[model samples]
Target: MMFDNKKVDSGTIGYFDTQQENHFFDRKSARIAVAKLSQSISAFANADGGELLIGVEDDKTWRGFASVEDANPLLDTAFDRLKSGYFDAEFLNSDHFPGFVLHLSIERSPSVVYSTSDEAYIRNNAQNKKVTGERLDSLRRSKGDITYESHAIPASLEDLTNSETMIHFMLESDRISEPSEFLRKQGLLIDGNPTVAALLLYSDHPQGQLPHAGIKIYRYETSGEARRDFLSGVPLTIEGPIYTLIRRAEETAQKIIDSIPRLDQGSGLTKIEYPVETLHEILTNAVLHRDYGTRDYVHIKIFDNRIEVESPGRLPANITPQNILDERFARNPLIQRGINRFPDPPNMDIGEGLNTAFQAMERLRLNLPYINESGDHVRVTIPHEPLASPQEAIVNYVRESGRINNSTARTVTKIEQERTIRRYFAELVDAGELAQRGSGRGTYYEIP
Candidate 1:
């Protein structure tokens, strides 16, 4: 799919030698067997897409092919393993190098890509891990190519037709069709049985059948690792139809957040709180977009300094934490549609929920939410800490302590790089706000 070739400079060649191989990049020699080359392409496609340089040696040497004809086998193997639109291949050439370097770019496919031998491989860190059994099924579900929600569940027709939730939903949405007809129209009924989406939306006690499809909230008094001694009370469990579940969970969480008090430098004491919109959007996203196939409830852990919302399932398709704000993929389309039909839907803006949550934090001068993926769940940690400029933090610390060192300043400003903090200190000194006293490790800055 790539039309133009990339011209490599001397600097680019040097970078290729020094750069380490990780999740997104790999280097292979032109002499690699055709079968091994196929596995690398499959691994990249199965996970997030990565780049493979075929002419690079294991020792970080530039040993390219003699001519275009010499690289044909590698190119042919890549194209045969991946579909047309799922990959791009381009040759890299430099006047400073001996021969051409084949560059193959692979993209995350909507479905799993198998090797020429008809075996599956997934990319983990820098290795190509073979997947089989349940993990393989999970890989397909996570990609959104197939969903467990579409599977049918055994239930009487009256269970859905006579339910109060279904009746109320139909009337509010202004649909005249009978309940059975509506379920059929929406693809929630299959082979005379209701699907998972139908049961979760209409059943008064969905947990009777799906016990883990709910929310569990815990309040921990400590900022460190959670322990039983730190737990304030018995964990509260909220279970009901999907609509009611979202509302009750949010209300309960807000009350707990309000009761916790924090000390403010200016206000003396105030209740710990986050933006209401942030809680609503994040909670709704966790419930609606989570993987119902996984047997676990969404978790809300309210720590003293932050709140953690853990939702089951990994990111679907090519969506990652880095690009979540710009990309959108729905694992449970039916659940999303059903919930959006409520009078005042929780997801009012749909795809912009996380974006809205982030902007609210910025508006209040608070730290933005941090997202992390672990095992089968994705967690979003919203810190109650405020955001202050590095220069402001340094000056304020010096005023209170009479002297500020590099280590203390880094902690105060939440900065990691020593050079960046030094730059800020230098700027403050040039402005006549502080004076440097010592050098190196013992360096300290105080009022002039």
Candidate 2:
């Protein structure tokens, strides 16, 4: 079987059985055991999603049920029984070739999922670890960092900002231009005291109040492969009010990007690797979405082939790597909203920044940025090269989607130059893989 829906290798056996994140198999058991299956299901959902192979053995050999038609019902029966109980199981799909492996893909739940025994378990490597006491509370808090941002700081208006900056914030939020009243209405100032958001936004040096609320940038002469910290020209730190920090950090990062060695975009020509808009959007997101509660500054490491911007805190709320494009959540709503009123604001559109950055990179035929999340931080990596050959990828896209335009082709192939799009389309047409259709301005291509 193969996950043709995604870009993965074609395999004939139970997929993800050996790989640990989500795959589980019970080979010794011939019948569908509800208790055992539900435990695995709950663990996978509570952590990251995974697959279950009912008949596969420890050695990766297939046994028992011969077809998906045969395995799905038995699995469904276990879920149906649990439906009216304390814990439940939801099986997405089961695919098998009768003599081969039965594969089931499980969806990870936003909240903690429990088994029939009412025990919530999270995955710790290959085993299911039960959550209790402080771990449970910590897991809930980690799910959404919004609670931390809502806390009012121990500072008063005098500690937060001067009257001028307060008046500016009031004006941007469309409130009566008074400091205390407007801030109180926005929940930023409480009885003449300021919230953490207000303190971070208005303070002369936010790092003085919040130790980790800054950015640390490094320029390495060698690529990250070298892992040579000494090779870096002394690190630079950008700290101040959120507004000032963004400006200084962006200017400094841009200078480093501008002066870096040009990269050959696999087309034999060396050019500046990343688009300015792409860099701006990424840098803005790193600053705004960071967790100010932690004592870790956002770290930006620039290398020859790639640039990595690692922001403090995990992804806020239910936003995951798979659902980031569609799900929107604000960890610091007050600060994010306040920053947008600055002249030529870096965070022009809050939710659309990432999508816009992706499109901008696609225009240049550069590899789109990727997100990596750990327990404490989310890191974004933007590289100079495309994930695949743009010309080849565009052709495959046209073949699959039926037709495409010059503009869409540019985005799909990461070809920023319009002439390049035309040339690539011409090449596909000449090879009889696609045929040009419609007239000028209404031009498109379809698989021939």
Candidate 3:
């Protein structure tokens, strides 16, 4: 069969595509390319599908190969691998290279493609990497058209809290057309037995079944050191029903927000400089997407100027920072759905929470949210800035008066007189140009 050279376009050079100086070619070795091909296929399937042209150059250079006679045998071997049921592969058309080139097209079905060993891979940017370890585990548990969300949990009926589970079932039931039947079809509860995911979401004491499921909130008074004190704050540990846990987390977050002094905007408006919705979205996301399989719980660290919410798990399969907003791979579908049933659940649609937080920050004209992933944990830091512009007033006060109290600073910056001068004090303190006097009400801030 003859192949049409016009069909292929220039792409990057990697395991999946071979460079011919000018054009690119798909790797010819069935055994050698199968692994990378599987990853490319999986990534495309996981994301918006795209074409994978072989025998092309990274810089759009194309050097035509011999002919179909030279590439057909390799193509046959590759097709056999797909037919074996170890992976999902499709044959598009070879018209592109009628005689001189070979073209193959693969599509992703709702079914996940696995290797002979049942291992999966996802493409990262231009590279195909194995989706293993925690990342893979999280992906396997994700909710998607062909994912395993419909599967039942392994435990017995006694493992679940029926009353609590029914409440969630009822709430979700009202939204869908057929609640009970849908629950049965989704394998949420079989023969009145809760699936592992169901138990985690609705059980009064989900931790009894999945002890690792919980949220850890910590407050630290930094002494300008890396590791410092347990200090004057409390560490709130919450577990049990997903609904209760979310509520507790939100309440805990609010308490931490309350602890930080509010800006004294002289105006009647009580606007927080940092978007409260942004904080809610980040914290809610941490709880929803966290990997419950790991013993580590979600952690919230309240520092002087910023709050960091660290969830236990890394990015889901085939997900990265660039495409995080465009695509969403929920680590816990059951938990996600359960949270949504709450009076105010988080927005997980297409990973919009992160984007919402970002937009909110941009609206407030504050710094961007800080995201860090280490090992199996993802930490998001949101800093609190002054709601009203205080730099000029702060500089004037410091330069003229030489010092000012928390109250005096706000007085000088009349822009928004109600906001406590604490924000200005914190900025100055962070800059190493301010010091505090006395304690409590007697405490006053002055330029040092």
lDDT of 3: 0.59
lDDT of 1 by residue, 178-231 (tens): 999999999999998988898888888778778899999999886445433378
Each candidate's clash count:
0, 4, 41
Candidate 2 stretches greater than 4 Å from native = 1-43, 51-106, 112-121, 130-138, 161-164, 167-177, 189-193, 223-231, 263-273, 386-448
Query: Which regions of candidate 1 are displaced past 4 Å?
Result: 1-22, 56-62, 80-99, 105-107, 223-232, 389-448
Q: Per-residue lDDT of 1-448 in model 2, one digit per residue for the tens?
A: 1222222233533345445432342232335566666677676666665656566556644455454455555456445433223232221223442243344455555555567787767666677778876565444445562345666777657655464555566566576555655567778865666777876777776676577788899987764575554446788989887887888988898888778766455766454558888878888888887776666899988886788899876676567876787899877778898777666677877799889888888777677788888767888899877667767888788768888999998777655799988888888889888898999999998877
Error of 3 at 434 (Å): 32
Residues forming the 10-long window of minimal summed lDDT in candidate 3: 21-30
Q: Sort by lDDT, best first.
A: 1, 2, 3
Residue 19, candidate 2: alpha-carbon lDDT: 57
Report lDDT (CA) for all predictions: 0.87, 0.68, 0.59
- For model 3, the superposed segments whose C-alpha errors exceed 4 Å read 1-151, 154-186, 225-234, 261-273, 329-334, 344-352, 385-448
Query: What 10-residue stretch in candidate 2 is worst by lDDT?
Result: 1-10
Cα deviation at 109, candidate 3, in Å, is 14
Each prediction's TM-score against the native? Answer: 0.77, 0.68, 0.53
lDDT-wise, the better of 1 and 2 is 1
> Which candidate do you rate higher for TM-score, 2 or 3?
2
